[model samples]
Target: MKTGNQDSSAVKAPDAARAAGTDYERIFHPRRVAVAGVSPGGGVGFGTRYLTSLQAIGFEGEILPVNPKGGEIAGLSIFKNVEDIPGELDLIVIAVAAEAVLPILEAGRKKGAAGAVIITSGFRELGTSEGIGREDEVRRIAASGIRVIGPNCFGIYCPKSGLTFFPNPDLSRESGPVAFLSQSGGLASDFMMTGMWMGLRFSKVVSFGNGADLREAELLRYLADDPETGVIAMYVEGVRDGSEFLDALKAAAAKKPVVILKGGLSSAGGRAVVSHTASLGGSRVIWESVLRQAGAVQVRDLQEMAQACLAFSLLPERVYRGLSFTGGGGALGIAACDAAETFGLEVPPLGTDARGRVEALLPKSGASGVNPVDVANPYAPPALLEKIFRAVAGDSRIDLQILIVLTHHFKGLAQDQGKTIEEVFPYRELADRMKAVAVETDKPVVFVLPNAKRGFPDMDVVEIHAKVREAFLERGLPVFDEIGDAMRAIGHVNRCYGKGETS
Candidate 1:
């Protein structure tokens, strides 16, 4: 409930000191976690689901479930109250009704819990006086000691510690440099799911719904100095304190890349946000200006945000000015150039010598070796494509390269050879060659594996394309479904580092 209008000196000295000395490590990597409001009958409520998710993720910590009329759940004894817990709790997840949230929170605070995540709703978002009063009470208890993640949220996801969202049991356990924060639990869950297939591994993800106490600004500052995080992404509807949020954003961006997806910029979306989180979604113009001023990369939607995070997580930190685009078909080449230019990137033509080498290796019938090296054949062999990529990358002006593979077209070849698309297209070999070429040439090569045929008849092709994408991603190459998405992601990287911005 901390607002922009609140004076800085209003915070109690002890509370400020406690906030300053927060045990983020224990909060994120707790050894003992408690879940309040779990059902003894094994129902699918948030608390029960969270307990199951923690188990599914292979959580190596002790889990204590709480319910007033508790028996047992998942072979673990359920405590009747937080006060009845045996020892100090590192973290507590509150999922009881709104009316019962404060008592559990107070008990956890008195038990010396490091933090709490309240999954219960019926907060200020209800837009009712009772709801508002309930939220204020929760905030007051939080201000006394314990840090709170939510009053209506999915809670935190830490890959390193096997802590997952309530509904997310399949999220990746492989930890990486990206940390994401969101006000919407659904968006946070969706992003984590999307990031799994998109080759985005995360360090931590927090959906601080309603953000009763610990929210954007404080979390930003914590992740800024977190050694495990290299890139920060956020789905923000609105912030409590504009000035504090900007300062935190600026500091975080200064330390590492911060990609923001500001929801509710449109009038209707803003109204939805107010109803959703009791937040004030400011004007789009103002948000854009503020993000740019804070030196953050602003994305439009979840897909774009995930793509930007992927680029930041995988690509080198330096900006890429010039690019070498390689693909089949004349139209694809044209599209690549247009997209690159739209993203402030240049597909510079290869040098005379390099162009000659590429042209010599390409088919003489319909191939071009200028910039967007058109092989003119969707079924180009991996060796030939490798030679072409190397030739294009030899240009000193080229800082990066993109190879667009029309993997779906291999279906025709598959049918002709009476084989599956995966059998016919040497995707693994191509991935290996691309990785080698990138290593030898000292230029990163992005892959665009477009599958225009996704109908029922083309399911085989779709499967093969997915395998191909996974292969490339395993080799440390970023893959995109379209050239525009790839360019836009790279463009974000360029805007962050190319302009000498804070990110």
Candidate 2:
């Protein structure tokens, strides 16, 4: 396990990640970064959105605005050009029009720029020789081995580095092990916010457009060395360099997990990919093989990617010996069966002695006291819940326990404006009971609630989603959107603790 770099103590800041062979901090956590086309108008120029986005997200390092006809963009003074700038440039994110990109890059090269993310589009996507010629020129400039993120990309956002491009994410105070990189700029920014809204922590979010200089493979290699990142998620419309991608993905898998959602699978999706990125849209079978070989999980949807991230994040460093999942409805148990089967998780039925032990403690009518146990009563006592969990999860064979609490009455619990809290559907009692059970069990427990959100249809005054999230965190268990996420966590725990070893 982890044979790539021996010194685990020195993982804080690895020097190899700063070199041409594998360094990504030069692009993501740059010391001196330049925004090549910041505008003069306060918030009216084409680039104002980016300038304001950067400041809004709170980039920590110096953000130099290099504009020939610039005075101020958001009250920040601008320099005339990169030539006039004085210092070592770690990264450059160019936001100028298509025609202005290469020229600004030339200026950036002269200033000792280590890398550049070209946010300008309209080059290779135009399907013209001139566009292709423009791409060639981009590669030529990048020949100095200065890493480039995109010619038509949204750029990267590192919460730890204060590096954000246009369409800056709604950064979260919570930072976790997941890192996301996508070839689709639109998807990257939108997904970042979506993940935040869904209670997910993001490590780094990048949109590597066009990949004229540095492709997905190089970036994968770079993220592998990042200490802050643990789970890697990616969305790809096209691939620029296959060999490099394979190498980087292999290295990354050796370090952590990489989950990907490819835009090209079916014939229709292939056409979409060809149109979106000018990619050739190679055979899907080959792509699948490559993914399996690289040890990356190819998730089906954005929701699945998020779920996979949570699964990979909550998993224990060691493997799990077994799993225990309890559902309120029989249909939910069937769904859990499918989830466990698909994820390669064991769902062994409880033995006569184990079932008898649970039945002895739990309310007779409330729980079936069986594996994939379905408690029949809807308003089952929370005390009964605490008791059953203590008995079933206490069994030494189980390592993870997942509780599915379907609560929609919380929306029904809404009180009229200025009304007292007592006249509401009491969902907290159940949540508290669940938390107590989880803490008592001493096993990692994931909670899933069906059909609840920030502001349900009944009330504009109260946000139930926010309240429940707060409640769960206060109880030391994080609330997930679906049982798929819960099971994924279980699977990851088993992977980590089982006899699996990486070469």
Candidate 3:
């Protein structure tokens, strides 16, 4: 996974290395990591968190904890310093105080560390003279051949390498085709967690705060050619070199879809940006124009970003004519039509052949035969739903088909039948049908539970939702909570990649 030519001989600042092309390949695939400033007792200190996170993520690489106290933590012997480590260090995590960062980095460099993730704050964001001077010193040290991720940030998460800032046992370790770079550490975690819930997995994620080193443009260029990454998402505030950033963004977008969510668009947000990462908040209009010209999709929130990434990762690489959906109630179908039109998506009526087939499979009492086909009682047999799925997906007029389930009503139907929802709904069979339809058709097939609720106190409902959603996700089908969000996400991807006639 060589990103580019490695000019390791030329010692240049990360920002100035645009011409030199510093290889960030080693940063994401390190074999041996040393965590400095780990304290005893294994409290939630940043250093301890990194150590535990690596262990919890089942990192196979050698982990060496460093502290001057020379004590054992979690039964691992703590080295007094990185220099005391037995072998070359591929990466080091620095969580010491502001004044203590340089010496640790220097020692790590002496121990042949290729990269360092500085999780310590109190640098330039402090707005103090000493802090500014310290940050400058960091830049100078960064010029000495060692790549850096942050001076005030959460580091990185590479599930393949089992490297994480914070690890969850239940999080998917299987690598997917999405990569994310964020300026805010908190936003990075939020995007990962939310994306996971939405059935989106990432190839790699970086929280590069302050951008003292490892500029966003360099990371963007690296991901552009990365074999594992098919979709790139970014949360940014500003860039140091506007022209270079634009060029890299354009290059990346030309190869794969790029979704950006720019923070600090508002005046108040701008002020917060300066204090948060010491970034310059560019004007919204200029940023929008630049993004549009670069052929990048600019999203407003994490939800939009996640959904757009999912669409790019899952949808077929073909032009879509319009979108259509089935199931749910008539009112929900009406809402879907409204939302689709609002997002510049068309809800054109299904072609006669497809409509005839769907209507035949559905009951005559309350079924909708047109575009947003309403199946009033969605508790019908799995075969009938699959027939409708195949008919709509194979239709010439419709490009994308959404299967809508009003979950509450489905559960009610199960109760009325004196059985559990799983017994009545046949989630496993439906998931198998959806997967089969997706693979057989060139058109995209998506499942939607428009009224899906989160954090339900009823464990039964929660378990059912998890089981169904997980089934779809495991088979490479995306599930959404609302029709509007699903369409909006698909619409953004369509517009960016020159897909549909409308959106």
Question: Number of the top candidate by lDDT?
Answer: 1
Tens digit of per-residue lDDT, candidate 2, span 307-337 = 6676677544656546677766778878887
RMSD of each: 4.4, 7.0, 5.8
TM-score for each of the candidates: 0.93, 0.82, 0.90
The lDDT of each candidate is 0.89, 0.70, 0.81
- Model 2 error, position 76 (Å): 1.3
Lowest summed lDDT over 10 consecutive residues: which window, candidate 2? Answer: 7-16
* Evaluation by TM-score, superior candidate among 2 and 3: 3
Q: How well does candidate 3 score on lDDT at residue 497?
A: 68
Total clashing pairs for each candidate = 0, 6, 0
lDDT of 3 at 177: 89
**Greater-TM-score candidate between 1 and 3:** 1
Give the poorly placed runs of model 2, Cα more than 4 Å off: 1-23, 267-282, 317-321, 327-331, 351-357, 374-384, 411-442, 452-456, 459-462, 473-478, 488-503
